[model samples]
Target chain A: MPTLYIDLMSQPSRACYILCKKHGLPVDVQMIRLDKGEHKKPAYLQINPLGKVPFLVDGDLRLPESAAIMAYLCDKYSLPDNWHPGSSSSSGQAAAHQQQQEQQRRAVYESAVHWQHLNIRAGCMRLVFHTVIGPRVFKVPAVPQVAADGLKVLQQALKDMESYWLGGGSRPFLTGQQVSTPDLLCVCDLEQLRMMVAEPSQPQLEQLLAPHPIVRQWMAAVRAAVGPALYDEAHGKLAAAVARLAAAAAAKPAARL
Target chain B: MPTLYIDLMSQPSRACYILCKKHGLPVDVQMIRLDKGEHKKPAYLQINPLGKVPFLVDGDLRLPESAAIMAYLCDKYSLPDNWHPGSSSSSGQAAAHQQQQEQQRRAVYESAVHWQHLNIRAGCMRLVFHTVIGPRVFKVPAVPQVAADGLKVLQQALKDMESYWLGGGSRPFLTGQQVSTPDLLCVCDLEQLRMMVAEPSQPQLEQLLAPHPIVRQWMAAVRAAVGPALYDEAHGKLAAAVARLAAAAAAKPAARL
Candidate 1:
């Protein structure tokens, strides 16, 4: 059995968790508490020099980066053809043509993952941190300019997601009819924004998500695809943490007086 | 044969060129001149809305992102087993174990490619643009603070590449003894910094490269792996462009007088 070291609060970690559960891969889930700073400690650093979350240890192999982990799992388990159709078990020109289409789909997914890293992932994470998490959880004051900048970039990404990727027609997901890993990675990031907006301290974040109907529809579809039980299980820690932070923020005025 | 829309000045474009030529894949290289803004034009924009270089068109499929392009080429051509050993033609536990090791190697390579995008690629591109390209080509004066910050980040990336990834001892390439696609991508970016340092105007850039002997050694190995004639063919345009820029920079003072 493989060991997966993860903290559910991290988007990539959550994605990896869902991917494993979705496929029914037998593995030990070792929770590395981020709040306890376990990930930054020397023990964790020894395993991964970068000391980042969602690393997989299978036999002698220690792998980090959610994209890499997901790709490896998809190959190792030989999961459904839809996940990575390029490696489909077929032959001849028909197979070659199918492989070409699959490669194109894979390329689009790869491009989205890379683009998400610099844009949506970075933008939404920063916005959530500056608006809600930094102030409420960490007790650090929010930087308005930085937060505003994050919101701006997030808005642009959402618009692009809706108009460019999703608006192409009746596609249920980012790539096509089938849900892929990039969809998993993307929806996780969007969930961060959704979580922050759910907090009572930041009603403004809701307005940021209000305009994009396509985003809402796609996110709902992702939720449905993941199923309610696993979705809740993956996000349970994060939801609870946000609730606790919101409650504390609400009680702060009474304590001050 | 597939048509590759590229500009040699772009690092990823050069990587794609080298990968195809190195593997002996049939490709029609259609050079898109960035200086003339060919990529931004309506015709190219219709093909790739993102308007980025190093995109591939094979029949109806339009693939972007160099990493994906390289992976697709590797799969479509079935160049070598080592290039993507995870997708080997075998089965059962023994094959699964071998696949596991191959996937681990692939994961490391994937992680490196993603890490390279944000760190080395972004940092070095910004550093060279601010310190060299912006001032020389665009007639925009260099921002000392921005250039300094870029140099700082790039130096840190170089140190990490040397000590963390390459320092494991006596490896001919990044992932292993054999040079992979990620190696091609990484070497191209380092070559950009190398090109800038070669310019008489930017002697300071040389200092950034001087401290890392491991980087130098790895780069040499990558060059050797690609072979001289093919390597020279791939880099010919970029070299000429750099030379032209250097000559133009040298002649500017005389013109002003």
Candidate 2:
């Protein structure tokens, strides 16, 4: 049994956990206490000298980084469909080997390519850029233009991805639908945006998500499938953090005056 | 033939080009011509609306981001031994399928893990912060503190990577001592550092190379393998860019005074 290490609300970490549970891959969830900085401690560093989360530890193999972990797990357990898009060959013979290799290559390529051009990364990076380094740290009014710029990048990404996945005649997940790793990625980050951004109900926000009805529908399905209970459990802490941020904003001298 | 839609100087694009060349993958180089803002043209937008460079078109596949490209190529090609890690499988059925699915998962996870840690990122970001944004845009003095801070992150990453790879171990790349994707990643970014930072041969720079004698040996090997002429060709532009920056700074009236 592999020991799956994570912190629920730490976007990428949550994605890994959700997928593992979603696919019903057999694993043990070892919560690395991020709030207490257990992730930074020496003991955990032995597992991952880099001292980061979303790492996996098997008997001999210890891997850190979510992508590395995802790769290791996909190869190790062989999940259903979406996780791995490229490589892997079941038939050892030279005949199918090329096709298998092509599959693996395709999977790796798809994941990497879509990541840069997808709304999942686009919206997520914007949220991170703003909330993580925005007015809070840089003390700017509407955050920096970089935050807006990040959103623009994401907006373009969403448009591109929507066409590929949901914009088409058929439409599905990030990689032509079918609810693969990319879809989960979108939901994981989108959930964060839904938690972070002020109005999820507004038209501009909806416009960002408007292109692909499949994405919208899939988002709803994913929220339902992941279960509203776990969804809230996973996102509740992040919500509280947002609340604290809002409270702090309210507590400011200008706000009080 | 695959079309590589790219601007060669961009750091991520450089990572893609090196991986393709180093692994001996064939690609048709298509410049997005950043200087003319050609990336924003609708024709290119049809390919990648985000307007970033180093997007790859393999047959019908269009992928972006260096990390994605590397993953895609590694998956698609026969590949050099160290491009990916782990033993090759004999059981084609289970092993191949598992590997394909996880490849994307790992790509996402590893890049995230590596970037999240301040080690290499801190240094790279510090350089961008100090040199690109700080002194240049933000109008801070050539604050030794800021540059020094950048060096610290660089040092820490080098120390960690060197100690791990600079060993009497089997593999000889950054992660395992053999040339893996991470090795390609490190070298690409490190080459930029050599130019952008002053005093390339400084001890802190060497200290990063020191812990791993294997890494040092491997660096020589990568240099040799990559060919000194090509290595110089690739990095030569960055060197010129830095010099241009310095000359422009010198030409400023305030500096003249």
Candidate 3:
């Protein structure tokens, strides 16, 4: 059985957890509570020298980085075809199943994966690194402008995503007719970006994810593919846990929030 | 022929130019002349909404990111055999590439690509963006500290590169015995870093590319396998450039020392 070291509050970690559990991959869920600095512990640090969570340990082999890990596992397990249909990439052009075959092919989907790599992921990560992790690790205040810039990039990324995913793309998913590894990646990111703007701009995202028919269709397809219960469960894991803790805090007003 | 908009100073653009000309890919170089603000012209902006340089136009298919452009070309023209050597991935122990026969299957390469996508690439880019490009584009002062921090990450990345490139793996190359797409990607990056990083601090780098026995041996192997003259010319395009520019600058009394 592979062991997955996870900190659920971290979105990518949650992404791995959701998929692994959904696919029923043989994975041992070892909790590395990032907020509590458990990942920095000597024991955990020995596993992942970099001290990041959501790393996978199988036997003597240890793997880090979400995209690599996701790809590694998917290619390994032969999970359901929709996740990443092997034959699709083999001879692809347009979306499969009329599935807007063009949408599914080497252009829009592939470009989106590469595009978000630099723009969205980097931008979102900068926000978390500067505002959240840097302060926690280095006692430095998040440079206000840096965080602002990160959000601005996020907004533009959303615009690009909306353009491709809804505006032009025919597939219900970001890539096309079916979900690929990118969807797994985006689920984690978008959940973290509940607020598209500096504040909780869920309204803006709601429109992008729902009202935008393509995205709305894609979301439904993704939810259906991933399973609605699992999707909601994965999305709400942190929220539910946070709400629970908050309730406990309210029950005892003197307790910490 | 595809039209490529590029700025000479841009690293990715430089890489694209080198790959195209070196491989003899049919490409029409549309010099964006970034130094003169041609990239920001409305004509170029219509092609790439970002108004960023290094946009590629193949018929109506417009791609902005370098990764996207590279993938497009690689897919379009069936590239050389060694370019994207199939790697054993995702599949666990059941994965059936014979270890001995599986010449290109690599172990550490997965994390290498992962790190490139996440930490190394993003870190260096942020450093470049915030420190170098920020000042160049926005009239801000170059922040040495930011570059230094980025350099630290780059240094570690190079350290990892040295370990893996030197280490015998599935392929003698970065991914394996075969020089895959990442090898090209990595070589370009390493070459660019030679120009960017200070000389004294890059002692290991100098040694690796120089008289150092084992390291130089590995570098030679990379150049030889990747095609020495082509590699040299690809890199030399920039080196001769620096030397000539250096001589010209030295001749100018008004130039800052």
Candidate 4:
């Protein structure tokens, strides 16, 4: 069994955790708390010198980066095609036409995965770190300009996701009908904005995703595909953080009276 | 034959061009100049809705993102194992030990590739745009603070590359001894800083790379591995841009006198 070092608060970590659970891939889950700086300690650093969460260890192989970990798991365990799409089974002995189609699908999937890392994931993390996590958790003052820039980039990425990946609602997920890892990674990253602003019932996620209905629909599809239980379980820490923020804001008004 | 749309001015585009040329892949190169706003035009956007350079079109398949393009080309052409390292051939009929080793290598390469997208490539581009590209090419005022932050991130990423990816000069390439696509992409991105500060004899590329000797060595290895003719051909536009900046600066002193 591979040991997965993850912190649910981290977006990619939760994505990997949910992937392992959803696929029934037996993985040893070891929590590496980012908030507590456990990842930066000497012991964890020994395993992964970069000191990032979602490090995977199986036998002699030590891997960092969530996307790589997820890909490795998909290949090793031979998960279903929909999860990664043509990534597990190699392109050996397939017909020429089928091989070409599989190559295209894999190419599209790879592009979306890379796109998520740079744009959607990077932008959302930038916004959350500057606005929510930095100020609230780390006690660092929020940089309004940086946060605003992040929001702008995030919105643009969402628009690109809708226009290019989702094909203006023509395709269901980021790549295709079957939900892929990028879909899960992207939805989880965008959901981080929920900590920014809360609506009457919904939070920043719903509002920020308001302009891109296609993206929201895609996110819903990915969540449903992963099932609500595993999704909630993986995101339990983040959800709790959102609830606490809400409770604190709700109490501030009554305390003034 | 596939068609590659690229602007040598763009870092990823140049990297892709170098990959195809070095591997001797038959590709029809279509130049999309960023200086003329060609990428944003309607016709090009029709081909690639994202309007990004380094879009690969093969028959009915349309692919964007440099890494994806390189991966697809490697698979389609069945390129050497060293270029991608276990990516070309499947794990069919391989011994269990060899399979595990191959998986580990592929995982590391994937991590480095994804890490480059978010950190090294991103930070370098951010710094260059804020300091060099924005002020010079786009006529946008340079944001000193943003540039400084970008520099900080870029330097940290270099240090991480040294510590983790390069393994303190233990590994010859990003993942292993053989030069990979991530190595090409990263070195190209870092070289973009040459536009910002030109040294007396050497340029900003050398000055910025001075602190990280391991990275400098790794870069020299990649350049030599790819051969100078193709590498220089791919980076010709960028080299000309850097030369133009130096010339303009030299002429400014005479004008002042």
lDDT of 1 by residue, A1-257 (tens): 88899989888899999989988998788998876779889999887776778888888877777877887787777788666544333344456556566556766676666666656775687678777767755577766555655676678888767866775446778777877777888888877765564355553545766888777888888888888799889999888876776676678778999
Q: State each model's CA lDDT, in order.
A: 0.74, 0.59, 0.59, 0.83
Using Cα atoms with residue i matched to residue i, what is each candidate's TM-score against the true structure?
Answer: 0.83, 0.73, 0.73, 0.95
**Per-model TM-score of chain B:** 0.88, 0.67, 0.69, 0.94
Cα misplacement distance, residue A175 of candidate 1 (Å): 1.9
- What lDDT score is found at residue B247 in candidate 1? 78
Scored by TM-score, the top model is: 4
Candidate 4 residue lDDT tens string, A45-163? 99888889889999888898899999889878889887776556565688888878887888889898888987898789877887678877767776655666667778889899998
> What is candidate 3's CA lDDT for residue B35?
58
lDDT of 3 by residue, A1-257 (tens): 77889887777787788779788888888888876788888999788876887798766566776655665566567565555433222332334444323322545544665566656676676565555445644466666455655666776676666674544555566765677767766666766544233223223346445534554455566667788888787777566654554455356645545
Higher-scoring candidate on DockQ, 1 or 3? 1
Candidate 1, pairs of clashing residues: none
Every model's DockQ, to 2 decimals? 0.34, 0.27, 0.29, 0.66
Residue-wise lDDT of candidate 2 within B1-257, one digit each (tens)? Answer: 67888766565677677766665677887777765668878989888765778787776566666666766666566565446532233354446556444453344335533452335644665555455545553465554544555576677666566554333445454544345565555565665554343333233335556665655666676666666777666667676866776566546656768
Residue A139 deviation, candidate 3, in Å?
Answer: 5.5
